[model samples]
Target: EAAVTQSPRNKVAVTGGKVTLSCNQTNNHNNMYWYRQDTGHGLRLIHYSYGAGSTEKGDIPDGYKASRPSQENFSLILELATPSQTSVYFCASGDTGGANSDYTFGSGTRLLVI
Candidate 1:
């Protein structure tokens, strides 16, 4: 089964601070994604990578960046945090196939910025 997990499940950051959220996957899948979930906006993709050493911007890449250094790991970086960035972030991994192959999501990382 594909499984993704994220560290620092909850975080509180000050304005203009830097925050890094880490994700690890055991599935060894070639596709991984970072997304943020908001009440009205649903889940919006922030970044994704096809494999190691590649990162691509997603629907809502603003104010966020991603890194995939290896098959099992990915990181989301917030260079200058702000209150608007407070939300639940999720890490997911899946095959290259379409919707037929669903992505597995981490529990989530709830970040609160002040």
Candidate 2:
């Protein structure tokens, strides 16, 4: 199995609350990504990191933040949770330099804003 794990598999918070989703990947991949899965937009990237201490904005970065503290850990933070932000967030790790850069996903974290 892929050595990736996500914390707090489910969460519920009041509007304007803060929510943090954590992930740990033991695969040692150079690239880590945070994505939110929604109804029609599909899986949209929220943020990504190439390595430790590096984070880059993704296609849909508004209202989202990411942190890569080390090669094995990445965190997704929602400073102000809103109902519109409720969705399933997934963390994936991959090394794009290889011939076949396949990603391994952590168990998604489902968040609900009330």
Candidate 3:
């Protein structure tokens, strides 16, 4: 079965720090994505990848970076974490590029910065 898994289901960080969110995708899905959900912003895409060795920045990539090492792995990194960056992050895998990308998501990682 194709599935996405994110680690450190919850996190807490100081004002200026670094946070690394890890994701693993199984089931040979060609497209994977990272999204953050916040109250006012709704849900915004942060990063995505087509396949192994390919990572692309999404709409709001200012404070984020992504890495795709293999067909089954992707990671989102916040080089300098801030309080405003605190939110629930999700990892998803799917068959993409069509009209609608059928995505299956991981539980989520909730991050809180102080």
> Judged by lDDT, which candidate is best?
1
Q: Alpha-carbon error at 86 in model 2, in Å? A: 0.4
TM-score of 1: 0.95
Ranking by TM-score: 1, 2, 3
Instruction: Write out the backbone clash pairs for model 3.
Output: none
Local distance difference test, each candidate:
0.94, 0.93, 0.91
**Poorest 10 consecutive residues by lDDT, candidate 2:** 96-105
Candidate 1 weakest ten by summed lDDT: 94-103
lDDT of 1: 0.94
Each prediction's RMSD over C-alphas, in Å, is 1.2, 1.2, 1.3
lDDT of 3 by residue, 85-111 (tens): 989999999886686678989989999
For model 2, the local distance difference test gives 0.93
Give the poorly placed runs of model 1, Cα more than 4 Å off. Answer: none
TM-score of 3: 0.93
For all predicted structures, in order, the TM-scores are 0.95, 0.95, 0.93
TM-score of 2: 0.95
Give candidate 2 misplaced runs (Cα > 4 Å): none
Which whole-number lDDT from 0 to 100 does residue 48 have in model 3?
A: 94
